[model samples]
Target chain A: EDQVTQSPEALRLQEGESSSLNCSYTVSGLRGLFWYRQDPGKGPEFLFTLYSAGEEKEKERLKATLTKKESFLHITAPKPEDSATYLCAVQAVSRGYNKLIFGAGTRLAVHP
Target chain B: GAGVSQSPSNKVTEKGKDVELRCDPISGHTALYWYRQSLGQGLEFLIYFQGNSAPDKSGLPSDRFSAERTGGSVSTLTIQRTQQEDSAVYLCASSFGMQETQYFGPGTRLLVL
Candidate 1:
């Protein structure tokens, strides 16, 4: 079974559109939840990390929130450049030092 | 100071050939990692390096896969007699310490044809 699952495998939106991507995880012990943005032909870039439920972080048009069982990445008034695959990962406590289990990311396309 | 940097951004080699990918982490970082991402697939942890201690090679898929870190900075992941299944984007990242946020480099995309 997939440890992590992301919904809406692909999404297309017009410029200034707002939407949210969901990431659900089932792990032995969730040490942290991470959100990343990846561009074509490039490595994934870190965006935020939430450790506890009800925790949230924001940067520009991107905001990530975490619950006990899932996490949400909300993009508000997104621009065309915001188009990219958004990845969610979990750091299991049993796995130490930079080891991460990632989900098949959501491919987001923003049209102008 | 610059972020993590990887070399040979793209490589295409015949099956059974050897390939080497390099990663130079930011100055003063103590943790380094390697991950593989196939097309339409999520990232797969390959290895981890922390300080000068023995590396965590548990994530390595096979004996043909191995990596090394020198001076606790730059790292190299080598695939011996690579198979078609080894083709993927190999990503490297460095962090200040264990459990810290990691900064990634633009990965090396390897295609074993």
Candidate 2:
């Protein structure tokens, strides 16, 4: 079975603190890995998509890197505004359509 | 351009009552998806529609859940005989293609009492 697991269920960091969230996945064939940020009572906002191992992408203060069995979301100098639940999902090549298997997510809090 | 949109930001209902949620995909998006998110949980895939193909409903939790995409633009999710466990945020997403990045709507919060 394909599964995704995110580590560190919750984290608290002071403003400007840098950290990384981990997502490990098991799939028949890796197709893509996605990162999303979700605010309270809001849907997830797309962050980045990594297709192959060793691939990385960035936006603003966030960077995402993918490997054979895991992916990491790096937050640099995070601000309170960046506090949100980070979600990681994986798309398997064996799936007929674009179905994504998602992890439980990691809740992050940045304090000033 | 406007992103995906869902109707009725919040809904309160009694158990056994039926509820319907709506979603409008992006202007030219050919793929639309529906998911359920519980408090402190990740997204649970519910259904998906791509162009004129048959919707993928494998993720629906029960037979009472059904969805339809009309004209490949707007989609509706209907839950029959809602249960307290059915309460959650229903999210809608749309993309240019099946493999493309999906943009999500604000989501509809459902509470069954």
Candidate 3:
């Protein structure tokens, strides 16, 4: 079965501290890996999409890198505004035209 | 340029009642999707509409859940005989095509009392 798992369910960091969130997946064939940031009570906001291994994309302080079996979202010197649930999802080729399998997001809290 | 939009930002209904959620995708988008998200959980794919066709209804959890897209624009997701387990945020998303990046709307929060 195609599935995605995100680790470090919750993380608390002081302002300026940085960390990485993990998303591991097993799919029939990887079409794309996506990262999103969601604030409470709102839909996820698209962040980055990595289409292949060794692929990386960045926006603001978030950088996403993809591998054959997993993806990593690395946060650079974070701030309080960067505090939000980071979600990871994957689109499998077999399920290519249909849906996205999402991971239970990582709740990140950065305190100033 | 508006993104996707959903009706009834919040809905509260008694158990066994029926409810309808609506989604208006960005103009010209060819694909739309509906997803359910339980509190503090990941989003679950419910259904999707490509143009006027829905080739996959297998993502829907039960027969009680149904969706339709009209004129290749707006979409509606209806839940019949709502149960407490049906309480969740129903989110709508759209993309230029089935394989493109999806843009989501602020979800409708549904509460089954």
Candidate 4:
């Protein structure tokens, strides 16, 4: 069974549209949850790291919130440059500290 | 400061041929990781190295895949008897000692024929 799952395999949004991406995870001894943005033919760029329920962090127009069962990446007034795949991952004590189990990702396309 | 870097941005090899992928992590980072992303799939954990401690090899898919970090810096992932199923984008990441945040490299796209 996959430990991490992401929804809306593909999402198309108009410029200035605000939305959220969901990431549900099932893991024992959750260490942390991570959000990343990946562009074509490139590695993932770090976005946010949420460590516990009710934890939230924001950068620019992006914000991440975490709870016991899931995490969300909310984008505000997104620009075309924000179009990319958003990935969510988790680390578990069982999997050790160095490995990250990633979700299939949500492909987000923002257009003007 | 530079982030993680990988060599041979792309590689094409024949089945049964051996190939080596290299990763040069951030200068002072003590933890390095290797992952593979197949077409339309998520990143798969492969192996890990932390300082001088023995690596965590549990994520390696098969014995044919092995990696070694020399002098706590550069790492090389060697795939022996590469198979078509091995084709993927190999990515490397690194973080500070025992830290949870890992920054990734651009990745090396490997294609097996």
Best by DockQ: 4
Report clash pairs, candidate 3. none
Tell me the whole-model lDDT of each prediction, alpha carbons only: 0.91, 0.92, 0.93, 0.93
The candidate with the higher TM-score, 1 or 4, is: 4
Candidate 3 lDDT, tens digit per residue, B1-113?
99999999999999999999999999999999999999878899988889978877878999999999999999999999999999999999999999999989999999999
All candidates: DockQ: 0.81, 0.73, 0.80, 0.86
Query: How close is every model to the real structure, measured as TM-score?
Result: 0.96, 0.97, 0.98, 0.97
DockQ order of candidates, best first?
4, 1, 3, 2
- Tens digit of per-residue lDDT, candidate 4, span A16-37: 9999999999998889999999
- In model 1, the clashing pairs are none
What is candidate 3's lDDT per residue for A1-112, written digit by digit as tens? 9899999999999999989999999999899999989998888999999999999998888899999999999998999999999999998888865699999999999999
If you assessed candidate 1 against the hidden native complex, which CAPRI class would it receive?
high
Q: Write the residue-wise lDDT of candidate 4 on B22-84 in tens digits.
A: 999999999999999999999999888998554688878999999999999999999999999
CA lDDT, candidate 2, residue B31: 93
- Model 3, clash count? 0
Model 3 misplaced stretches (Cα beyond 4 Å): none
> In TM-score terms, which candidate is top?
3
lDDT of 2 by residue, B1-113 (tens): 88888999999999999999999999999999999998767899988899756458889999999998889799999999999999999999999999888889999999999
Q: Is candidate 2 or candidate 4 better by lDDT?
A: 4
iRMS values for every prediction: 1.2, 1.2, 0.9, 0.8
